[model samples]
Target: MIRILLVLILLLTPYHPNSITGSKDKLENQISTILSRIPSNTKTGILIYNPLTQDTIYSHNIFSPMIPASVTKVFTTATALSLMGKDYRFSTILFTDDSNIKDGTINGNLFLKGFGNATFSSEDLLHFIFKLKNLGIKEITGNIVGDDSYFDNIYYREDWIPDESANVKLPPISALVLDRNKTVSKRKRGRRTIYITENFKNPPLNIAQKFKQLIEENDISVNGVAKSGITPDNVLEIAESSVAITDLIAMINKHSDNFIAECLFKSIGAFYSGKQSNSFYSQQAIQEFIKKNNIYSINTEIVDGSGISRFDQVTVASVNGVLETMYFDLKNFESFYNSLSYAGVDGTLRNRLTDLPNGFSFRGKTGTLNSVIALTGYLMSDDKDELIITIMFEFSKGSWNFYRDIQDEIIKSLAELKKESSDF
Candidate 1:
């Protein structure tokens, strides 16, 4: 008992209470001053961590649960990396439950089942056909039945810009989908062509050439017109340059590709824990993951992984909860961080931090929809301390100035804090 008391005394002796108190005061003052500086009516929130004082510099509105837009990709990508190993590859398989085979002339229709294989590429597709060929399956006699039953048919978020949604590229979600929900159209320029088929039954280019010839036979010469089209029900042949989801995501973050973002969402369900490979089970899985991980509470309702939904809502506490979960998983932590666009290098941060303070911070993901804007991810101070920051804005009409200025104010303040810490 006496020895314990002695140890406690020694532990307390060197502890500087005033120093700790001073640090708190400094951090609190900094946060308050920064919050006060924001000019807009943006419903904004923030979180900061100071390693020196072991403080979780934080703000409450951070969990205001605003629309995230494509920023929802952050959740999806993170979920994918967590559930499906980073190295896990999605495979597109071709198989039929029949015994008809005769030099590419079978009596039954060909079947194509898609499992949201985001990685499905021309090469992978070719490989699948080769596998089919190896099975002595040469011809399909029946029409292609694209098996998209793997997922529930819940495409399109509750809130989407109608004008943007109408574009076929931004088509509603579907199982057994292909190519950013679009198809390639090719036309021939040379004359002497004939026979064009609207069904695209075979040799599309040849058929296109034939069409041009017919047009010429009609005494009309037009060859340079590119054909406009949607992807075929069954990918008859693989291409050498069709972009896959990996590249899409690469561009998705870099250029903020909304089309690619939505197309890839279906891939999540098809890849894992889905009733059917093409089902939109991603949201359920995410909720379960959140519940199982005990990070966010069960109340967080996520419509689309992307925050394009106006009905989506998350709490500040839950946001922190998710962040806390991320802090421990190092591999996931790294992947999560790396996946975000670098301030100037890529991702949503392209024009953001080019000449700004937080620009040079670690990296982050940005979300925007109509009147909503948000920023989240890691930030580092000059002292080498890493902080997780989540900023969300829900500003009213004529709140643009306030929305931007407030975020900038918050960013500038963090920059100053970083600078101040480095001075020591």
Candidate 2:
């Protein structure tokens, strides 16, 4: 009878061969193996957290601040989405002090005013001019002036390297930007082709010149030259072009556009302070956001909106905190989540992590500088488990590919983690 009772007890006892602790241990081991491949001299910070269960799957030097590079966009975009709302739009307006239209002629200057629309291009300006023609405004006695006073006169941050000024990606930051402050000239030589790219020294003036060319092409006459100035209030609004903040954030985060990121950064400050936007006000606003969301980190510093400034630093913990806050924010979560570049999908991540198992994917933001590489985003599994992952490396030696490989290996191991089983 005792033997029979022992057999029954053994049969009734639950056998969980794949417990949560065991699964975590396996994950930790895999991650450690991957991390071991990293060069010892590299500064690294990593964190993986399960928001649903409030469990920290893994963490290493998560509080140490490192150069975030473009990963800073994650914070700038999230805060903009939260404060400005997803539907907010930045607009460029054509204002006229003289509204008199007698026989398709305007007597005064046409002021093209910009409110930090980063996507504004020559095409948009052409459309604005066409709208003027449609409105029977064929002649302007005054100049086609560009008004960019919405933001401060500083085109680029003081901390940025002076040599980066000519880079097309580091175009001049101005409220009035046309064609992203870039000029492309194409020429054909005997069976060969050459392209010349130049940055616009005066973006607003360039906008005015382009506007003048478009106006002349459309049979409109301008009596004066293109110039830059401030727009006076209470002017008659004639035409406008605008882009939604949602779209701006999408571009900024997915493509890591430094110019747009800077523009939107200033816009955030202008939105809150009701004053001309600048880096200082924008930094203050971002700090306010960190404080408000209780994600403050002593190591975190915001010198510019885009991580191009090497002075910008952030702790992995702070980045994870921002991700967590955005995850629970019901109103802005969808926009923020959808804006991230998907692994093996579109955006900068199009060619990355393509080997992820079926039904598993990652949506992340990538940051890279000469000596820094960072990736942070959500990793979703086939079992519906979501993990927030942040990995950053700052090294004096080694190529970006080496660090990227380590990051990819670590992610692959974490992707194998399953909520209900240790087998993964």
Candidate 3:
């Protein structure tokens, strides 16, 4: 009878070749094999977590500080959404000192005040013009002044590479950005046509100039030239153009737009302090957010919103912390999640991971610099389990493609994981 009982007990136990331990071991071995190919001096940090189970699936140098390139947008966007809310909007207002109009003329200067609307464009200016025409004002007797005092005068971060100044991605940061602070002009030389692209040294002044030209083109007249100055407190508001924070974050995350990212960063500082926004206040705001949420306990430095600054440093653990926190915040999670690029579908990842297995998907942000590459986001499997993964490689001496291949492989391996089975 005892022998019969023992045989029944043995038969009742289920066999799991892909048990938790076995599957975890397999994954670790696969990741280790991939890491072995990296150069000796390279810094690597990776962390994978199952949010539903609150289990850390894997970690490697997770707390080591590494340079994060464009991945910095993840933190910036998350913080902005948490504090500013999805309905927040940046406004550009037009004001005039003279409320009294005689025969469709303004007796005083017209002020174009910017509150760091990075999407402010010529179309918005046209709308302003239309509004002015409807107000029955065809001429301005005073100067068209540009007000950019919402943020500080510093245009570029000190740590940005000077050689990359001409890159469209590195356009000058300003409160009054027009067409993303880029100016393109056509030039003719030796019977051949060439185009010259340049960044505006003074974005506010350029905007004022463009506004003046547009006014003239629309059959209005300006007696004075375009100039930069402060908007008076007593001016009467004429018109306004605004963009929601939701759209701005999409540009920051999906396309990795540096200009918009920086604008939003400064806006965060301005929003909290009600003072002129600068790097000092902006960095303080981010640090306060980190402390309030207990995001990480490791050493990290955030020098700028866009990861273009060489001084920016973060760990995979910190990155994952932000991801997990945003995931649980019910109010803002949807906006935050939708801002990320979808793998194999849209945004920066449109051309990447196109061959992912059926029902496997990744929605995340990609960061890249000369020798740095990072990816962090949510990875969903066929079984409906969601995993947050962060992979960062800094100061690599090998080709970036090599490290990217390793990242893709790790993602593929994790995506193949089954919720109840260890088939991957």
Candidate 4:
């Protein structure tokens, strides 16, 4: 995987935008200036639409298939909303056929069943513990077993970027997972080559001491680190887990968390097709969903729902189509759309689209790699018109300045259209 990712990086050399060619008044000219200032090596795919006519007004490599980075979340979140209703909430359940409850001790295996809830958390796990305690269960004499029958246990996709910081908070897809499968870490004052970490999951009071005891018995020293796990596949007691789906999405859309995004992608697959959803298979599900919805077919490619894969691609039309669909279901639509990173406020867009009118008016998911930058989502024009737009840069050549320039130009054009339409 490292070799393949490295090869991809080598092939993705930066290219600045050299020029923009089109016939839409000065829009193209302005865009061209921005593009030219960017190195010609930037790989950019642009598509603009006149929604009144439902016609494309400007396009360049609109469907050649390139990476979209976090823009892939649009599909993951959208497909999830479609397959699972917006109001859906994932639940974790405890079941035991025989419980020999006696003096704070139960003599049966504590079973955990995973139900494809991507938002499960440590605090939530604590809630489950409370539920169990409410049933007069204080201690268990038998081991724990996780039942992740709802999802196939195929964890990890081919598209994740490996250099990312790992966390136990990010757990593997299992029939039984704690805290959305995340582990905990403790920050150490020293920067030793080996960091302090722990996989002790569950209510801290119940298992922390036990976990330390076991580690001590094994002679593996811990540095008392404070960090979470990426994903765990072990059978452990359920403790305190507070992170939930709502928090997960906030991190995903606001911080462009690639790990959570990857997890959500797999969860989407697990939800519909069991664990049979791989990058190829899950993308098929999303693509088919798009086709069924009559969205543009030729403009999107998804290898991972998180857009981290270099193979993922998307278009302004497809994104616009999604936003248009949301117009019909405000409840779910708002949930999904609101999850997107606010420009300059959260996620990947934190530093961008900051100075627009009305405290700025773009709601988008931004994507960036070595040389690629993409922005796709809805823009609220100064005239109160909501327009869906995308400005993507692909390459061997790409530049942040170029992407920023084209994005501004696109917004400018939309604002102009809003004024023109309002004059009538």
Candidate 5:
């Protein structure tokens, strides 16, 4: 009798995917109503997916081609994580052309050759200088040369606006990046542009100059003027970058560092092709990678790693696919996911979603341009399900605050979503 009762109960519990579907539809409708209040002239693209069930819960204008702004870093970082392992570390080597030395002086020029390490900083330079001092070569007979020959001479994208150079986020793209290719000036009126500078025309030359200063400060004599040059095959490596690739990816995504994104993009091309890095090669590699992942979309376009260019276009569905693929990737998920900005916690999202209710966490990237706004990342809904959400907007006349509010509302609604219960 007990066995019979158990069998009956098991047989009576029917599959209720349709009920869940109905709930999802209702939730989507409610969110759509909120989205409609933003602006009539705005072109929007949105997609929400359940990575666990591998289903798109809600989609609107998912196929529309929209400018993603900095959200394009999602594709850049994801492709990088897939191609380069999370533990990968980019090396910026300090080499000496000649090995012979006497009286603590080098007989040849010092070469600083970078293989696409964007996180290279003043501290790294100082540490390298210390290492040079430890090498018992206090004096250098030749100039300090910065070699970024791993990439092309085109440091700035053709499509980027000339005025955009004033913004630090769009720093010069180079293989050897030091302090993000920007110089810090004394503050005035409590105002200073993060990316603005008096001179950054040549990134390698700028880095070389800074390196020369650090060397001189460290009491290591650099007799020669710093300039951009190439290191010979026969050279002695002095120092390299200590930061891991995951950390660099975090910097790129969390802060939306355009310089790092472009460098990484070019590095991807250089890595795969073993040739000089260029945007065309990077886009080809990204396109091939996108295709290999089966993320097919009619309108997907990528010209630069960072979405600072107005020419970049990507479909909502394609970006969703990219996010879903990265989230589910077993080996690289932690590094990739942790790199995103966590809403109300830190990164670009440090101040957003502060007024949300309990059981909500929006971890993602935020993108903003004069006419574009985008937010894409993960939303942990009530600790029961995880949703991948991407919200993009291209507006003619609307305040960015309004768009951000709408995006936050959408995320809030999704976080509060629940499955319907059946009453038979």
Candidate 6:
């Protein structure tokens, strides 16, 4: 009876010596065929590596540097997660000189000092006011100062074009960002007409004035103007930001927010350099990180964290290295993986790969600049392999949709790879 049971088990199990290798070769062939269909004028870089098997399934121009666009955020956010833990939270403190007050009246300036909390919002101001009310502080006798001294004076990248600077998405990045350093106000010109626009000329002033309004609404009196100033030597902590660093990463990658990326980049610089952070210092910190991880590829250059700069470049192999590192680190794996835009689901990928029925989950970041498109992240194959894939294109002439379709087709072919069953 035991012999009979063992024979039945052997008959049911389907194992082959060459199945894994054959499937890998087949997947590589499909991907190569798809890449061959690309226009001759266009150049592409592709890499698909399986971390579990320690296998390089396919590589095309993998070592050549290409424009990464916003896909560069994967490296930025990954380094941030490595340096700053998943639980790290930025704090925006309300400091006042008067520690002892009589009946909710402070006789000194109320300073709002920021530590690069990019997600800080106007509602947080109200919460601070509430905290002040609870602390028996009803009036501030001095200016409601906005202290953004945590960073340098540079607002935007020097290479950023005028048209790109004109965008609301690319606002003046400062340490103390309120409502993402921009505001939109509704105006009524006529009975049935409405107009809305952004107000982002001065981030500190915008935050100061809004904070004053919220304080007044909270029944607290402010008898002084709101302006930019440094925090005094001795002050009491009133309130701090409640958002976590992990969520800030999500805001940067999932939305491809150029503003937040710059702000967070400066924060990383400050954390590493132990000095007032600027974009240059941020770039230096990123360079140091790449060196520490041995991730630099040929001609790889970076000018900004968001990849909005046309100067930023990365090789497919380099991007895949970062992806693989994040995947292997168990402590940060969940946070880093979840921060990417999910295909057919949310973030920058909400409108892409919607009709594909691949039995896998695609979490990646999409990047698009004029004539350049990049997609990089992890693709869970139907065979339960975590595939690190990066597809980049620098076309002489082509629509973004054109390149995006090719990227999707290559991934579809990858997801469709399977091994033939062996008959007993």
lDDT of each: 0.53, 0.84, 0.83, 0.57, 0.81, 0.79
For candidate 1, write residues 138-171 as lDDT tens digits: 4444443344455445555433333334222344
lDDT of 1: 0.53
Q: Write the per-residue lDDT of candidate 3 for residues 188-280, one digit (tens) a residue.
A: 999999999899889789889989999989988999999999998888998999999888998999898888999888888888788998887
Model 2 ranges off by over 4 Å: 1-18, 159-169, 186-193, 419-424
Q: Could you tell me the lDDT of residue 52 within candidate 2?
A: 55
**Residue-by-residue lDDT tens digits, candidate 4, 321-396:** 6655654454566776688877767767777766665523777777777567777776655433355677777656
CA RMSD per model (angstroms): 9.5, 7.3, 7.0, 11.6, 5.8, 5.8
What TM-score against the true fold does each predicted structure earn? Answer: 0.67, 0.90, 0.90, 0.71, 0.86, 0.88
Where in model 4 is the C-alpha error above 4 Å? 1-24, 50-57, 99-107, 159-176, 179-250, 274-281, 328-331, 397-402, 409-424
Ranking by TM-score: 3, 2, 6, 5, 4, 1
Q: Candidate 2 residues 164-222, lDDT tens each?
A: 43223577888888888899989999988899999888877888888888898899989
**What is the lDDT, from 0 to 100, of the residue 102 in candidate 2?**
52
Candidate 1 deviates by what RMSD? 9.5
What is the total number of backbone clashes in candidate 2?
A: 0
Residue 70 miss distance in model 4 (angstroms): 1.5
Which of the two, 1 or 3, has more TM-score? 3
In angstroms, give how far residue 309 of model 6 lies from its true place: 0.7
Residue pairs clashing in model 6 are 104-136
Q: Counting only residues 3 or more apart in sequence or on different chains, how many pairs clash (N, Cα, C under 3 Å) in candidate 3? A: 0
Tell me how far the alpha carbon of residue 345 in candidate 6 is from the true structure, in angstroms, after superposition.
Answer: 1.8
The digit string of per-residue lDDT tens for model 5 on 9-63 reads 6468675877777778777788979977876888988888876656677888999
Clashes of each: 20, 0, 0, 68, 1, 1
TM-score of 5: 0.86
Q: CA shift at 185, candidate 4, in angstroms?
A: 6.0
